[model samples]
Target chain A: MMTDLPLDQVRTLLAVVDEGTFDAAAAALHVTPSAISQRVKALEQRTGRVLLLRTKPVRPTESGEVLVRLARQVARLEHDAQAELGLSGEGEPTRVSVAVNADSLATWFLQVLTRVPEEFRLCFELRREDEDHTAALLREGTVMAAVTSSPDPVPGCSVRSLGRMRYLAVAAPKFAARHLGGPVARTLTEVPVVVFDRRDDFQDGFVRGLTRGRAGASALRHYVPTSEGFVEAVAAGLGWGLVPEPQADPLLGDGRLVGIAPGRRVDVPLYWQQWKLDSPALVQVAETVTATAAEALRP
Target chain B: MMTDLPLDQVRTLLAVVDEGTFDAAAAALHVTPSAISQRVKALEQRTGRVLLLRTKPVRPTESGEVLVRLARQVARLEHDAQAELGLSGEGEPTRVSVAVNADSLATWFLQVLTRVPEEFRLCFELRREDEDHTAALLREGTVMAAVTSSPDPVPGCSVRSLGRMRYLAVAAPKFAARHLGGPVARTLTEVPVVVFDRRDDFQDGFVRGLTRGRAGASALRHYVPTSEGFVEAVAAGLGWGLVPEPQADPLLGDGRLVGIAPGRRVDVPLYWQQWKLDSPALVQVAETVTATAAEALRP
Candidate 1:
């Protein structure tokens, strides 16, 4: 079934998706816009699927995403072959991109790079997104690998458990004393809370568990989007939040922050997903990242 | 022409796109999947255009994006009307979502939140994206407003100049003495640089300017995705990179960081863009954000 798909059309589909317009894709692929259009049309006819939405910045239909993923895998294989064959262009560093969550990027991801041998001569591009959405990049063929919360493999990728990342509900000592002096569940609903963003529901989920799903975190919440700054905001006595365990440790020990629910915490299971290809660079990254996660994260 | 598009069908179409699947959209809209399919099909028939690509997660066609924008405008108007007539649901906070860059989020953006009047009962949802891409959220209706690098307004939105964010080429004193003790242009390519991520080119641009466009910053760069952390990494002597002027001031004043290039700097002009509607909540937020940016950023 896969053999029926033409390589040029698949690569053209990826170019159009990446460049966002037929004209731009043509410029990127060094062809005419009409050529780009005809190629896409031919590919759609061949696949018997509507491949694109043709938006201002073009969006791939689900069918198009499949082809885009295939294009990336092919590109990865070609790059690896070039590298192994000593045919890589002079001084052209091999570039690898990975999508990672903010918490992991802030906490322990750098150590992975340190472990990479200088001999690898690789350049890394990191995309910071939420753990739940990191896999979307892999699905889109934007990143070769991702540190994602989903255990499910993005088709063509293999998944391995990286263990659970624990989070603690904590607040500045002064803030807890001032605003959280009452009953845990009810008081949480009344007091101000800090969240990573509107999409962040960890604190609300924690509150719901305590209140039997009767209430949510306060509507009067502070949206601090960065992981490091989120902890800083909580420690600065702005609001209480569910802070990642490692980030909260020093603050908790130094009394800058106090655990409100010492017995309650959230453990988000993380997984490392990468393309199932025989590429040395990708293999080294996976091994290094997995090894670091094992040491830094709780199983 | 506007009357031709039924409000229910329009809303349902938005639901389908947002929810990603027909079944999910039906569940979200509290209707059967068959009903959702019928509404969308009817809408497409009336418009004489294919509105969606029926894939796993359906994508809105270009024409569909137009209707989605219309649906969002209608929703905003309805919410504003309810608020004005004092018919808003009990304890319903006026929610305002804004997309901003990391530098703004870490620095002056929070000040806008602090200035929101308590009487307004506003809930802010800040979406942190790159400044160049934040306007896409506005265009997609994911955010009501955005701080963008481009002055061009998204359709159905207005734009205002927010002034320039200056970035200085900086490094730790020890790093500068150790690695950058030679000619500025050529040495910059040899020394490691710190960048916010792969998309970051400020350091490369700085180096290119010095070298008459013959070179770029080192490929041996450290990728730090957070603004604050990027500065900290540079100050820790990991690499030399461009630091936002405001964030770099204290470090420069304290001698933790040194200017790599005395005169060379990058000034990224920013602008605020928002929906062109007369909602009091939106108006208040715009005024607050604009006033704060005027004070905090350079014109």
Candidate 2:
């Protein structure tokens, strides 16, 4: 079993992955290409596993991901330590990397950022991904924290329920009159619909629930990948979709959109998952995010 | 010399890449694991190149990307042909894949979709990527068309200028008063700024231009990722940034945001590139996108 990895070798591996090639990594690190190759080779030999594929832009092997994650965590901890010791230069900001779903980012997540005190001096590196996939970034250590649909904590991390984000099925008023003339279950299965992406099954899941699992949303779907654009597309009569309550309420109130399925709503429970690290910036962000979610999301 | 590739083998390679494993590909294709293995081996033998990395979730080699692009393009052409022959099932929408930048998607691109006549019966697969990178998707055949910043066409694709997207450096009225108390160039380098993501050097590039390459944007940057969120972040006094003209207009009209750098703007020239195909759906989309862009974008 591996007990510890050499810091130089581990950091070299990360550099190669980030820079995409040994020569590039060497240039970035101000070392010779041969030195980068030697360090990577030594790391592979020490771990007894091939850590990288020698592609044009090197790709990390599954085993490499584990070590890469470790390198990032170590780097983060070192930054925290330097800041605490006052060794980090004055006014050097701490970057807090977090993955958040697009809807949350467009709505309440930005509110959390506004609430963070200026004294924290935190620079956010926000990665926008789907709620279902955000946890994968956290698991891969690409991010220190994530807003995810899953409540289960990643190994070595802690999870807390943020609250449920409610989605209401809606459409333009004219679109409802034209296409949704019959029973919602049957009409919805034939009319055009809007979806976030190919991988997004939220609208289909909503349709499936209404149809007793007999059908899904129409094949004539408009893929509007952004959360704001998705809402606008539905409002423009391109198709119907399950819009987040916050985005939907304004359009619904203004007579631009109408709730197609009254009293039926899909509530996706979101969770905050983060590495159990005692970094001050991370702690402060977690508190602000949790507090904001309490007010913004359904309990 | 390589003359032709067997369609079955090419499709099998695509399935394996998409499904991430031989076993999963086998299940998806309704074939045995052995059959999947044999087909992949046969393709490799015929091509005389290793196509896959054999990782847990399989990854394609550089040569494999070439074949994957070919497979996707072939699939697209086949779909188009089927539709032309009226052999596609009734009400089957022709799927058109195109990549667009988030800013364009958030602003004018949705209008292009709204203009498409319902008689065409098209299903759009919109991939949201940065303008700088959208051409890669077109080259990979992951998308049939793209809104890109590149004037040069991807191989086998044609390009047209879509006009320029102007960005204005702006900030919340209070943020400006607090931070921009000195010369514009000097203060911008020290104050907080908002950016789209880590890869976004637009704000930095803007500052560099202003400072005659003396500096870039401050290290105290907040990455908001989305075009809309970045604007909101700036308006909320999180940081100042270059806001796209359409998004900035309303805020600037109201007392919420003020143009910090007056009479100075960064105009990114946009282009529409598409595969040189004869598909009616693709043709119609290109025409609509180009026309809409002509009106919305700066000449």
Best by the DockQ measure = 2
Backbone clash numbers for all candidates listed: 0, 0
Q: Mark the 10 consecutive residues where model 2 chain A has the least summed lDDT.
A: A131-140
Q: Extract clashing residue pairs from model 2.
A: none
How many angstroms is residue A158 displaced in model 1 relative to the true structure, after the best TM-score fit?
Answer: 4.3
DockQ comparisons of all candidates to the true complex: 0.32, 0.75
Q: How well does chain A score by TM in each candidate?
A: 0.96, 0.95
The local lDDT score (0 to 100) that residue B41 gets in candidate 1 is 95
Worst 10 residues of 1 chain B by lDDT: B131-140
Q: Put down candidate 2 lDDT per residue, A1-299, tens digits, no spaces.
A: 44577989999998898889999999999999999999999999998999998978888887897788788888889999998888998668998889999889877999888888988789888889876567557765788999988788877689999999999999999999999988999899999999999889999999999999999999889898998999999999999999999999999999999999888999999999998888899999999999999999999
lDDT of each: 0.85, 0.89
